[model samples]
Target: MSEKEIYQRVEEWLSRMTLEQKIGQMIQTERMSITPEEVKVFHIGSVLSGGGSSPGENKPADWVKMNDAFWAASVEEDEKHLPIPILYGVDAIHGHNNVLGATIFPHNIGLGCANDPELVKKIAQSTAREILATGVEWTFAPTLAVARNNQWGRTYESYSEDPEIVKSYAGAFVEGLQGDLKTDSVIACVKHWVGDGGTTYGIDQGDTDISEAELRKIHIPPYIPAIQAGTLTVMASFNSWKGDKLHGHKYLLTDVLKEELGFKGFIISDWDGCDYLNADFHQTVAQGVNAGIDLFMVSEKWKPFGESLNQHVNSGNVKPERIDDAVRRILYVKIKYGLFEKPRPSARYWSNHESFGGSAHREVAREAVRKSLVLLKNENDLLPLKRDARIIVAGKNANDRGHQCGGFTVAWQGVSDSMDEESDEPASKITTAYGADAGVQRGKIIGGTSIWEGIKAMSPKAELNINGNMADRSRHDVGIVVIGETPYAEGMGDIRQGDETIAEMATKIKGLMKVLHPYGHSLVLNELHPEDLEAIKNITNQRIPAVVVLLSGRTLIIEKELEESTAFVAAWLPGSEGQGVADLLFGVYDFKGKLSFSWQKKAGENFRKGDEPYNPLFAFGYGLSYSNNTEN
Candidate 1:
């Protein structure tokens, strides 16, 4: 529909909605919190599947069935209600990652290293298709964080620290995700608006203590292109700017984003984001609404939030015009995307499509993995190993799919096959704390080939010895040691000084003492997985030409590991398609990824492209290929 037509419809719907209904339109609840009947009775506007919240069995058909029920509930006509379709959103960050069998793509950090906007767009396209197959209409993806510090746990979510790279990729990602809004598309949400990656000491949801000029230069540039490309939604950041929480920052949320940038779509609060604004629930609701958040992702607290919002509006705290404006924006997007006219979830064109995680999608993911593998060190040209060479694959990450995918995979913090055996306790009984196991069935978490499996598929002579046991080194021609950070997200992945025990630190790094920052914090990688270095040493010490493939979310302190390897490749969280790593090792593909972030030489050293004293192990944009030895 045209702009005039959409506006007319929005106004018409806005006129018909009651105050309670309008407030309902502004609230989004988690699927597990409310029943389908509650969705209809409460007139809820949106529903989402939080990271691990899935339907029975979590298959494509199961998702469709679940979505169909909710869709039916929302549109069921009644005397006091007007039917409005509810938008279903999920965190399909890297492919439809939350669902089983979806083709998981490399995390944004790896995509940034690939430095191909077209390839990123293709990945977005494939991601949208897979999400549609599962009956979800919206995906909270294309995280536009200009991550300055690698110590931040979510550095992998950022495309690049350089605004130019993020700016170049933003429009392409939006275009690919939205896709004309006619067919095979999902609503794109360009997220965590403004400076989520510039937090102090790389703390997630911490303060960004930068000047407005610096914030615009380093962070806000990416959102301009995303807005220009017509992203239908923007998620407010959980972090604060200059000690002010963004959820209640009226100037940035209203004056800058909606008025100045001309963002026509609705602005959404992150999960329970308003709760961070004030101690009182009513005050939080008032502040958030007045600050111009169009929708609130209240999760389980939707009912209480809705009731509180109603009281606030009735008491003249939240203006009725503001409520109308929020409703207008919501209706405008719903109508513009044809969500009102679209068929039920099970009847949609791509619903339960056979190509969900099929060969074609996996091929695109493989290409991304191949393009994203950065050849950090090719000492003596040890890479491009012969396919028939006898190989010994070692390291914990070598055979683990969960570690390869990293965080935000099947679960919120991601899962590992090597994680402790499933507890008999129900998933509900498990705590959602930082390091707590959420009772994930590791065996059924993901569907993909491990690095060892991929290598073995190409070369039958490959042997799997995860402990790096070289009982007979003479039989092996080469060793492939895959190592790096395990699965973690947000605060759980932060680099801190006191996290490791003294004995644990010593055992991980034999003679080297833990490198502490001037402030007594440590950003060392050895403490996280010291076994990685041990495996590398075990192979290299035996005089085997070892190739170290590091699978991590961001750059880590790897000087010791690099010193012991013949060749090193930064395979930054390559998802699902392990064969892509094998493709490069076996000479089927060449290394193309460059350093999206500068490689840190030591623990606790934070440096960017233009920072002073910018000595790094390898400079930004550095990579090597078989044909070209020169760095870009």
Candidate 2:
């Protein structure tokens, strides 16, 4: 349909919708909280599968069946109301990562290091296809956060700290995910609008204390390209600008994004994002609506939120014109995406089991993993190891698929093979009727090759000693130690203040003790995961040439680890395709990735492209390759 036709349809739908229906169109609920019948009765406009929230077997077919139920409910004709298709969204940020067997691509941090916009676009296209296979039409992805501080937990989600790199990748990603807004594509949401990564002390959802000029220069540039690429939605950030929360920031949400920049699509709130705006629910609804949020991702609170929004509108706290505008935007996007004309979720053009974790998608993911491995240290040219060399793979991350994928894989905070006895993190709690055991069946649970598996694939004689212990050390030619941060997301991954004790940090994170470092609150690579350093030391002490492959979300204090290793590779969260890491190690592929973020020498040190007294362990854009014969 043409632009005029889309607008005419949007206006026609806006004119007919009741106040409740319009409010429903503005609300997005989590699937677990509201039933399919509830979605129809309440006229809920959107539904989402929050991180690990899945239906009956958590398979592609299961997702299609579940979405089909919701689709049927939404379009079911009744005497009282008109039928409107509900939009189903997911955090398919990496590669439809929430589902098992789906090809998990390199996280955004790794992709940033690859520095290939075409590759990122291909990954986005594969991600969209996989998401469509599961019957989801929208994805909350291509996180445009320009992370300034490495201490932020979600640094891995950002493409780059440099806004120019982020700006370059944004349009390509949007274009890939939303190809002409057709049946095979999914709606792309460029996210956490403005300065989510520039928070104070690198705190997740903390205040971004910067001048508006600095904000535009560093943070807002990425969104311009994304908007230009015709992204259909923008998720509001959880963080505040200076002291003002973004959910209620009328100037940025309305005046800047919608009016000045000309974002035609809807603006959405993050998970319970409005609740952070005000103490009173009604006030939050009013403030959020007046601030120009087109949709509320209320999660479980959709009904109460809808009721509150209705009351706020009736009491004149929120203008009817604002409500109509919000509804119109929602309807416009729905129509533009061909949601109104499409059949049920199962009958969609791209929905099928073959596309979920297909070979072609996994191959793209493997190429991404190969391109993303940033070789930091190649002293004496220890990498490009012979395939026949006797290898000893050791460390916590060496054999763990969950740790390799990191956070936002299968679960909200991601899954881990090793769970602390005292901690009740998401990894321990998640079960999909696939299995009850967490550690033993974790590989099958998330479905990915560990670095150990990749090594064995190439060299079948390679021994897997996870703890780095060997009775006969002389048997191994080399020891490959894979180590880094375990699975964590948001506040759970934040490098706490130096003054804050582990006990205090644990209390703040609601007793999630697994994430707390026993030593101190710091970004030291060893301190956070001491066993990693121990494993590396165990191998190095035996005079074995230790090849340390660090799988982390961001640059860490790695001076101690670097000192103990012969060759060090900063493999930033290579997801599902550990063979790619092996490819670099075994000479099948050379290292191509450069440092997306500056490698910090000290813990909690803040350094960027233009910082004064700019001393880093390794500068930004640093990498080593066998072809160049470079050493760092």
Candidate 3:
């Protein structure tokens, strides 16, 4: 339809929709947080799986079935006269991430390393197909934050450190999400409107203290491409620009992004972002509404927010025209997605089927996992492991499913037995993502062994040993200690703040050094942060020539360690591949992968909180190996 025709229909719908319903259209919720009864009662606009949020019967096919049930019940016989289908949402940040079997593409930071926008687009399009199968139409993805710090919990979610890279990929991802926004494409949200990844110290939802010119230069470029690509929505970040919270920044939200940037989609806020307002709940609602937030993600308490907003409209605090504006935007999106008429009927959704995590999608996921691997350091030709070598493997994360998957897996920000699956081929692990959880078994590398088990498997000649305690006998050839911050969610309650986690981790590394110092055997440490090299040497500063192996998500600050260590390996989020790591350690698989995100220079937390220029310990895509040490 023509733009005018679309506008006329949206306006007509807004005029007809009740204040409650119109406000409902502006809110979204989680299934657990709300109920079908509540869906009926509140007449909520949409629902989503925040982070790892999913239903109990969360298999991909079952997800389709369950969603259809909710849609059938919620959309049937509605006296409130709401829109047709209730848009379902998810954090399909990578390859329908929450859906167990769908292709879990590498995080955006890794994609940024690929530096290929076409790849980004293809991944998103693959994700769109899987998402559509499950009856989900809206995905909150392609978070185009120009990441300034790797310390940020969500840093891996961002596309680039440069705005240009993010813009090209963000637009590509939008195209992938909607398969061309001009058609009946899924909605796209180019988010955090101002600066999210630019926060100092990598803090989540923190502040950006740059000038207006710098902000526009560094952070605003990505949104331009996303808007031009015809993204359907924009989610305001919980961060701040200059000194004002992005949610409350009128100029950035209304004037610049909507007016100046020429973006036509509606604007959404992060989860309960409106709660950050200075006033009481009601006043907070009014302030956020006045500031130009279109969708609140108000959740179950949407009634209170909607009611307060309605009061604002009635009392002249929030212009009625603004309310109409928000509703019009919402209607425009629903129409664009064909939700206005098609309504994503329950029957079209496959409640149970063979195609959940089928072979087609798995091939893409395998490619993603492989390319995402970054080869940080390889020394003395110690990589791409040989077919046969007396190898010793050790570490807590080795062979652990929870560590392989990292955060936002099946559970919310913690550990779990998630990645135990057979390596049949490069097939999609749908049963895991989309829930064929019945067949999951203890992950085995077939004839190969885990670092601990591998040691025992190839004992005597191989002499593999793994334990938390130091080795009493120094007969072994080398020492390898795998340690770092354990899993944590949100405020990081699992990992003790300060040096407790880092200190213990460092101590454990030093202990290994002391044990193997006499032999002068090479030392390998998993999750070795670059900043710890000095401290490690200061622990003894002599003997036990070492190799630091990083085995965590995102990149790290690796400086002194780069020079001090004989070998360094960046096993980029290797899942069920501890044996694969051991293979590389024993010179089996060469360290083929290079750094995805930039590394910072040697420094102590160069976050741009005060006057710092956000100095990184290393540059992005910087990795060195003994075999292939040439820089990419």
lDDT of 3 by residue, 1-632 (tens): 77888888887777677777777777786666776666656667777776645665456666776677667655666665553457788777666656554544555666665577776777777777777767777888778888776555666567667677787887788888887543335677777787877754444555576788888888889888888888898889877665477777789899998899887778988777777655478877887888898888865577677678878878899887888888788778877766755544345533343544555555554445444455555566445443344333334444454454455544445233422224322211122221123343232112212333333333444432223133323333343444333333332311122433333333322111001001111112223332344333432243433444555555544554456555565544443324444544554334445454556453344332223464544445565544556666
lDDT over C-alpha atoms for residue 297 of model 2: 92
Model 1 bad stretches (over 4 Å): 418-437, 440-442, 498-521
162-200 per-residue lDDT for model 2 (tens digits): 998999999999999999787778999999987999987
lDDT tens per residue, model 1, 74-140: 9998887779999999999999988888899999999999999999999999999999999999999
Give me the runs in candidate 2 sitting further than 4 Å from their true place.
Answer: 418-446, 471-473, 498-520
| Model 3 residue 234 CA deviation in Å | 1.4
Cα displacement (Å) at residue 500, model 2:
6.8
RMSD of each candidate relative to the true structure: 5.9, 4.3, 9.1
At residue 96, candidate 3 shows an lDDT of: 62
Report the candidate with higher lDDT, 1 versus 3: 1
Top candidate, metric lDDT: 1
